[model samples]
Target chain A: MMTDLPLDQVRTLLAVVDEGTFDAAAAALHVTPSAISQRVKALEQRTGRVLLLRTKPVRPTESGEVLVRLARQVARLEHDAQAELGLSGEGEPTRVSVAVNADSLATWFLQVLTRVPEEFRLCFELRREDEDHTAALLREGTVMAAVTSSPDPVPGCSVRSLGRMRYLAVAAPKFAARHLGGPVARTLTEVPVVVFDRRDDFQDGFVRGLTRGRAGASALRHYVPTSEGFVEAVAAGLGWGLVPEPQADPLLGDGRLVGIAPGRRVDVPLYWQQWKLDSPALVQVAETVTATAAEALRP
Target chain B: MMTDLPLDQVRTLLAVVDEGTFDAAAAALHVTPSAISQRVKALEQRTGRVLLLRTKPVRPTESGEVLVRLARQVARLEHDAQAELGLSGEGEPTRVSVAVNADSLATWFLQVLTRVPEEFRLCFELRREDEDHTAALLREGTVMAAVTSSPDPVPGCSVRSLGRMRYLAVAAPKFAARHLGGPVARTLTEVPVVVFDRRDDFQDGFVRGLTRGRAGASALRHYVPTSEGFVEAVAAGLGWGLVPEPQADPLLGDGRLVGIAPGRRVDVPLYWQQWKLDSPALVQVAETVTATAAEALRP
Candidate 1:
C-alpha cells in the first residue's frame, strides 16, 4: 500500500550502487556504516521489493536499479535547476551525463556535443552503449538521453523520430564472386559472415529475412567491438556483413566491396528518446541531433 | 569548468518552475524574492545559458528543460535510496516515475506491472508520450526508464532488443470497398486514411513504400488519437488505417473489417531501453517486458 517513496532513500540506493557498499556510502555521507545498512534495510521493507543484493560491493536488485537510476536523474535535474535560478556557486561546472550507442557515436551522435553553447559551462560524461540498450541507462539514471530503435517512448518521457538509417549488405568484389553464387536470398545462408559480437544479430537477422528462417551465414565469427574495426573486418574479407550504406558506399564504388545482392537494403529507423525535461542543454542537444539526423539519414 | 553542479541550485529551479514565479520560489524556499532572482541570475552567469523565460507561469528554455528533468530524476533516485537505506518514515512507499507511449500501454506494457512484487509497495506515475520521444524523458531525468523506438540507449541507460511490432493496413470491409479499389498498392494513395495526430506518418510511410515515392495516402485524413479509438475509427468505416495485427485480427475474423491487401505487413523492430542500473524493480520490469514482447510481437 506504499504509494510514495522519499527521495532521500532513493538517492542512498544510487550511492550504494555507485560506491558499491554500505561502508562506502557511510564514508561518502560521513555517517556510520550501520546507519547506511539500516536505511537500505528500511527501504527494502517499505517497497516490499529487495532493492539491492548485498554482495561484497553491493548491487541494486532489478528493482533497486530502477530506483538508483531515478535517483541519478533527479540529482542531475536539481543541479540544472539551481544554476538556472542563478544560485550557483563560485566554482564548479555541472556535468551533463548521457548514454548513446556505438553506431550513432561514429556517425552523428558526437556532433551533438559540438553544438552545446559555450555558456552552459557544461561537463560531459559520455557513456558508450549499443543503441538497442541505451534506454537502460536512462532508466538507471546513468544518462539523460539515448539513441534507440524503439518507437515507443520510455515511461515518463517524450519521443520524436529522427529518421531511418540505411544499411547495405556488401562484400569484397572478389569475395562475393568466390562465395555467393546465385540469388542473394538463396546463397546468403551458406556464405561465411563476420559477426561483430555474440549478441550481434545483424548478420543473422539479414539472413533470416532472405531465407525466412532456412539457415544463417557461416559461423566463422570476428568479434570486433568497435564500429570502425567491425567495418574494417568486413572490408578485409573476413566475411560479408550488413554494413551501414554510408560506410559501405565508397568501398563498394572503389571495387573494394561489391553488392552480393544489390537493390535490397535494410532501413533501420532511428529515433532520439530522452527525458521530457525543460533543460536548455538537453534541448540544444536534441535540436542539433535531429537536424543532423535529417541530413545524414533518410527522411 | 563546472564539472558538477551543486544540488541546491537545481532544487531552486524546480521550486521556481513548480511555483511559477520568483516570488513563489522564494516562498517555497523560505527566502526573499530578491534572493530568488539573485540565485537564478547567478546560475545563468555560471552556466552562460538562459535557463528560463520570464513569464507569469515561467517556461524553461531548452537548456532549462534539461535541468527540470534532471532535478526530477535525481529526486526520485534520492528517495528510493533513502528508503533502501532505512531512512524513510515507517510507512512511506517509493514512487517510480516512468515515461511510456500510449500504444504499448494499450497493448502489453501493463504486464510489466503485474510482475512486480506487491511488497515493493511502489506507485507508478506513467507519462504518456510518443515512443519516438520517450528517451527525452530519460534525458531530462523525468523518468527512470522508458519503452522507446530508439535503440541507442539513453546516456546512462542500458538497452535490449525487445522484438518487433507488426502492423497491417485494414478497414471496415465497407470502407475498403468504397474508397480503395483493386490492388491496394495502387489504390491506397487515393483512399481516405486515419492518422493519430499532426505527426502521424505510419500510413504515409506505408504508402511511400508501396508507390516508390510516387504517391502518398490521401490528404483526406481522419485524426483519431487513441490506439483503440483509432482502430475503431477505421473499423467504423471512417477510413483505412494501419493497425497492429493483434488488434485487427478479431475484427477481420468477425467480418467487421478486411485487409486492403493481404500478406503485406510492416514489422517495426522494437527494443527495450532502460538505465543500466541494477535496481530490482527495473530488472523485473525488463524481464517481464522482454518476455511479454517475445510472446506478443514478431521476431
Candidate 2:
C-alpha cells in the first residue's frame, strides 16, 4: 500500500488543498491546471476514495484529510533530510511549528525556546490554542508538535509527561469579602466569575469539585483570553477565577489577589507530544521543553 | 413578521446551534426533546425555510445563522434594558464582550478597559483574534464590539476611526549588517523575516511596497503568534519584520534593534466598531477606546 502511493500525486493533492483550487495550485506549483487535476484524480483512483469536496475553494473530505496529514508528514521528513544533507539554501533556517496553550506561551514556553542551541539556526512558528485543543492541531498536521492536555498521542506522534500546571482559585480581597465570604461552593455558583474563554471549564470544574457536582461557576462571567490579562482581571476584582500558579503567585504575595478557596487548587496535567521522527532539531526542542516543564510545572 | 418570530423560538435556535444537538439543547433549555422538535418546526414554518441541518450534532443553515444572530442581539438588548431598569440581580455587573486583535490587546487596548468608570461596574469579556477577523465575531454576535482593520461596519454596528497603527521594518543591528547590507528591497526577499502568523501580510506588503510589487518577504520566516513575543523574536535577531511602532521604538532606542529601512513604514488604519445600542456601558467603552487610540496611534 505504501508503494502504491506516489509522492508527486500526494504532493499535488496537498497543493490543491492549500491553494484552494486547481488553478491556484497549478500557479503555486508552476504546473498546468489540467496537470494538477490529473494528479489529484490519479491519487483518488489509487486510493479508491473520493478525496475532495469540489466547493468554492475546495474542502478535503474525511479521506482527503487523512492523505493531507500523510503529505505533511512526508514534507516534514523531506525538509529535515534536505537540512541534514546540506542541500538546503544557504542561511535557510529549519522551521518547527508547535501549538501551545496561552498560559504555557506566557509563562515557561519562551524559556524552552531559549534553551535550544542557537547553532541549529531554528525558526519557530508558534500557534496559541487551549491545551485541550492543541492536540487537534497536531492531528490535523497543522503543527509538528504540541503542548496538550491529552495523554493520548496523535497518530504518528509520541507523548511524554510534562508535569501538571496548578491553578489556584483566587479573587481580590474586596471581592472575596463581598461575594465569596458566604458558603464557598454555593456563593461561587451565584456570584460573577472570570473564565479564560468560552471553552474554559477550569472555574466550573473547580466549583463542581468543591460542591460535589452540585454547582458550577456563575454565568455572569468575564472571558479574558490572555493568561496574563486573565490574572489581572481577577486581581482587579472583576471576578474570581482559577489562575495558573506562575501567574497568581506575585499578585497573591502583593495582596492584589487573595485565595478564595485556600488549600484547594486545580492541577491540569500537561503532556509534550511531537512527531515520532529522528530529526535532531525536533529532539532538541522536545528535550529542552521537557526539562523546562519539569522545573516550572508541579510534579 | 418580527412579532411572529417569538423570542423563545429564536433563543431555542441559538441553543440548538450552541449545544450542537437537539437533546443537548433540550437539556440546556430545560425542555423535553418533543418540545424542542416542535419549536424548531414552528420556526421553520414561520421562516418558510429549514433553519437547521439536523445532523448528529445540529448545524445552523444560512437562514439559521441569521436568526441566531438576531437572538443574540435581542439578548443583548434585553440585558441592557434590565440593567437600565435596575431589574438585574443585585451586584450584577454590566457585561460587554469585545473581540480585539492581539497587538491592540498587548499595546493600548487594555488601557481602554481601565478607563471605564467604576460606577458602571462593567464586566469585560475580551476575545483576542486578528484585527482582520475581529469583525466576524461581531457579525456572528459572539462579541458586542470589536477593534477591526476594516472601516466598513458589521451590519447593525456603528464604526469610529481609531487611527493608523504604524509598522516599521526593523532588525537587530548585527542581523542588518550581515543579511541586509545589499539593496534593501532585493535583500529583504532573500533574508529571513519574522511574521506574526500565517495570516499576517504586513511584512509581505512592506516588501511589495519597497520593490513596487516586484518582490515579497522571504519564505524563510519565523512565525511568532504573539505581538510582544514577535517583537522580542526580532530583537533577539531571529529575523527582521514590520514591528508595530509603539513596540519597536523602545527596542530601537535601546540599541537592541535598528531600522532596516529608515523611513519605510506601513500604517494600518484601525476602527472601533460596536452594536448600535443605547447601552451606556458600551458607549463609555467606545468613547474611552477611541480617545486612547487617538493618543496612542498615528492619525
The positional error of residue B50 in candidate 2, measured at the CA in angstroms, is: 5.3
| Candidate 2: true contacts recovered, fraction | 0.51
Q: Is the docking of candidate 2 incorrect, acceptable, medium or high quality?
A: medium
Candidate 1 runs further than 4 Å off:
A1-4, B1-299
Instruction: Write model 2 residue lDDT over A233-260, tens digit each, in one string.
Output: 7887878998889989998899999998
Q: Over all chains combined, what TM-score does candidate 2 have?
A: 0.89
Model 2 chain B — which ten-residue stretch has the worst lDDT?
B131-140
Please compute DockQ, using alpha carbons, for every candidate against the native two-chain complex: 0.01, 0.49
The DockQ assigned to candidate 2 is: 0.49
**B1-299 in candidate 1: lDDT tens per residue?**
43477668877887898788998899889999998888777777778899898977997777887777667766767777887887977445555555656566556665554456657655444555676568666765666777766788777677888777788889888787676777787778766677766577889999998989988886656555556656766776767888987888889899998988777889887777676665666666667778888888788
What would the per-residue lDDT of candidate 2 be over residues B1-299, giving only the tens digit for each residue? 77778889999999988899989999999999889999999999988999998876887776787788789888877887897788988657777889988888878887776678878878788989876567667776778899888888888789999999998889999889899878999999988888988888889988998899998898778888887778877887778988888999998899999999977788889888888887778888998898999999998
